[model samples]
Target: MFRLSSLIGCTVLFLISCGTSKKSFVMPSAENISAVKFLGEYDIPYNLLYKNTVVGGLSGIDYDKKNDCYYFICDDRSDNNPARFYKAKIFITPHGIDSAVFTDTRSLLQPDNTVYPNKKQDRLHVPDPEAIRYSPVLNQLIWSSEGERIVKEKDTILANPAVTSIGLDGSFKHSFELPANLTMHATENGPRQNGVLEGMSFANNYKTLFVNVEEPLYEDGPRADITENNAFIRILKFDVASRKNTAQYAYKLEPVAYPANPANAFKINGIPDILNIGTDKFLVIERSFSTGRAACTIRVFITDLHNATDIKNIASLKGNSSFVPATKKLLLNMDDLGIYIDNVEGVTFGPVLPNGHKTLVFVADNNFEKAEKAQLLLFEITE
Candidate 1:
């Protein structure tokens, strides 16, 4: 079954400015700026067996215009099943989403044309995928993995994170050359454990690819907390043809908004998804969760790289520096749209609506938990 909700009281304002620069970013008034209105939501039952495979943990999603189908990537690390992605057909009209039907499932393959083995079967660390996107230039799907970080008795093993490409059939294609600084290191510096790559998107021209980590690197700063201090994450731009990182910028993450629980009072906030709106503009999703709540806080923002400092060579963003983070404008908060919120990790521009407005879609990762259900939320971008 599905649920429908009417959009209401969706007004929000975000003042974006660099603390070190004179430039300021102010979103146009709500009357002028386009609003993403909630449409409907559908759930994929937890532990629903399909073709002998459990259907859950859908973390990332992309729309394939050519096939008129949506590709959802499961965050499963070959624990319950081989790492895989599902092809789903989502029927939509001007009113709302009609139905979301799972069509097929494909297992991700390695360069050797073999499916990824379970962690117990192979001693090597398996990938923890967080984001995926359809690349028009390569005619394939590009995905990002948050590599593992394990500290042992005598040594610290850091598996380098990666952005890889694969065909619709799940055949291995190739991988982008990541910058050395972004790699996991045994030293105290570099990307933190589980804070590696997460959000990914391609530019409108399809010539440049953008990716972002979930949290700050060890050298940058600390993860977000319940204070005024905001953590910093990096966004890297890659040249598609050259497969090299071209530019890097600092992104500031807001602190956790919810109060912590006394028993298990840890809070987490990070960037999970990014979408290209224009040449240098993007829509980024910042999701924050506390230990005790079934609901998390999700916010959408519009940002641009104009006048932002390029820190590709600089080692750290702390101390005295002139680097300016990207300016952001808050678009909408999912909680204000009168719909249930979960772990929203994926966002993409969907097909055009009957009213000629652009459509935006979000998918949640249920973590295969019986208490949660894989959800797909649809919205219309009204300009």
Candidate 2:
């Protein structure tokens, strides 16, 4: 069992896995234990009045150590505003986060130097940005979009998901060639609607990049239901120099821990953020939302692909298979922490704490709703 502590306005949940060792699986131990301490929380006003433009839907965040600033990607999709990202300054101290103030904003533009058109402007799907990461190797930002699926006149139109790089000035840099299995198709064996790429990170000294889909591919498995056996998401690692996926593995997601209504069982689970903490190891954020309750359950886990089978060439993971999925250990569960959980969609390593421990920051996607707020939560990690 994990330990829990009550702070001034937040609760801290220290999670640790407990199990005996098996032949194929390694049991978790205190030596592998990591703890997350609640530092502080802040919320940017919804439709925050800034520069005469509304700012909300902060879905992804990345830290720029070079400038000591943070970049937040808004999944606005040109509806409320053009697809854009914001540059902000976050003040931190040994105690916790002091303040986060927006400094400027940049709109993502097409190669033609024009802003992406909204859905209303064009029947075709626009970029539904989800996750963004600052690339130290390229000195730019890499972002992922969960492209939409449209059906018109009995013809299915698939807007393929994309991982694109952009300069700090918001100019397009380059786009990576994704595997064919990731592209959406009209058949039942393709990616489900809005279930394409989401979380992304760079590892191996920024030579290799990793991207994950939100749900199982159409042929890999069925979407998560109320059962304990949830979907298995695909995690792909790309070699920057080669411009191709070098390896891939499967990550099993847990079923919705809490259902807003038992009868309806409207539950959702997906990967929203990922951070490279070590070689072939990552800190992954699994966000589960239960509709009607207006509440979310967010958990952080450390996963390693040490001996996992690479499924990059396999189109389906549902049939009889002998492949091993990545091993994972739970790190933190925000629900047990007693913090108000929202749609947490972003996570990144922040500046080192005064005590030398690394800081972890999470940001929520408010969907630009007036009733919801763009919240930023800070946590300090101890090994």
Candidate 3:
């Protein structure tokens, strides 16, 4: 979910299929996983104030194994406060997520050491912060910003999307060099607003990074609708050391789960966050929401790039059949849990349970809505 109003891989193997040819495949150990057990949920009181800042739009989250804590990027866009992230400690018991306490908050600073301003202050630089990841190797937090694209206003503003890393204290560290395609344009020739650069994660033992756009770019194809089952989005890979995009691959997005009310209300289905589980493999989240629906439909899937074609140089993917998209398999659907699922945008591996089983945690962005509740859900990976 991008708007404030909308309450929104591991083991690669090579195989020889034909006598004279070789085909690559990824068979992650997670494929053998038997079930996902829902533990419990904790709601961060609506608009809970911490460090004098209103905390609600928690869009992206990452587990800091070294510090035994978590870092969450707020999709605040510097509206209520400067674009920022929070360090928090979420205590998880066998029964559920017991409690959560905010430890610290830091404003993401620009190269000039100033906090990002709101659109009203600087329309060009106002950032729509979406996803964040903690790089233990660099001891920094990397985040993505869906920069402004104001076409309706008299003054045109086009702040290209960005991916940047910051020091532990939120000081500027480095800005990634993005490709030309990610730049926002005046016409519908590039990324759609609020649909670019949403999910990111560290892969290949922190040597490589992966980031994906929420929806397809204009040149790629059409936005996902109730009947568009083959909508495609690009996932960009980066060499962490160089901080440049190395390759890009297409991933198919599932169709919109439900039809919008009144036949034209707001509705969408797109990826919000991702997690690296093994080499070249990841866990992806597909969130779908439509107007007049009581809750969002969230699906967790596993995908890998072993057989996927790199589309970095391909200008368009519409009706293109020369490339193969990453293979995906459904793992879990939030609707099956029988719980009220909000706009879930983040997912990460949590601390191991006392029973020795690994854990998975998900967080929801409330969009700071008074009627909505910010949630933290826990689950056990029973293999």
Model 1: lDDT to the true structure? 0.82
lDDT of 3 by residue, 258-282 (tens): 9999789999999999888776778
At residue 275, give the lDDT of candidate 1.
85
- What are the root-mean-square deviations of the candidates from the true structure over C-alphas? 13.9, 14.1, 12.5
Per-residue accuracy of model 1 over 1-383 as CA lDDT, tens digit each:
33332222222111223334433322111223367888888887779888878998888888876678888888898998998888889998877788888899998888887988766886466878788888655678888888888878885656789888899889999889999888787776899888889898888466788999989998888888878675889999999787799999988998886877873587889998988887578888999988888887899988888779889998888763678999988998887976679989998878877777778889988999988768888888876
- Residue 249 in candidate 1 has what lDDT? 91
Kindly report which residue stretches of model 3 are placed more than 4 angstroms away from their true locations once superposed: 1-34, 153-155
Which parts of model 1 are misplaced by more than 4 Å? Answer: 1-33, 154-156
lDDT of 2 by residue, 278-353 (tens): 7678888888887777768898999998889998878788863678999999999999877687889998878887
Q: Which candidate is the best by lDDT?
A: 3
Q: Which ten residues in a row have the lowest lDDT in candidate 2?
A: 21-30
Q: Judged by lDDT against the true structure, how good is candidate 2?
A: 0.81
List clash counts for every candidate, in order.
Answer: 0, 0, 3
| Candidates, ranked, lDDT | 3, 1, 2
Residue 269 of candidate 3: its Cα lDDT?
94
lDDT of candidates 1 onward, in order: 0.82, 0.81, 0.88
lDDT of 1 at 38: 83
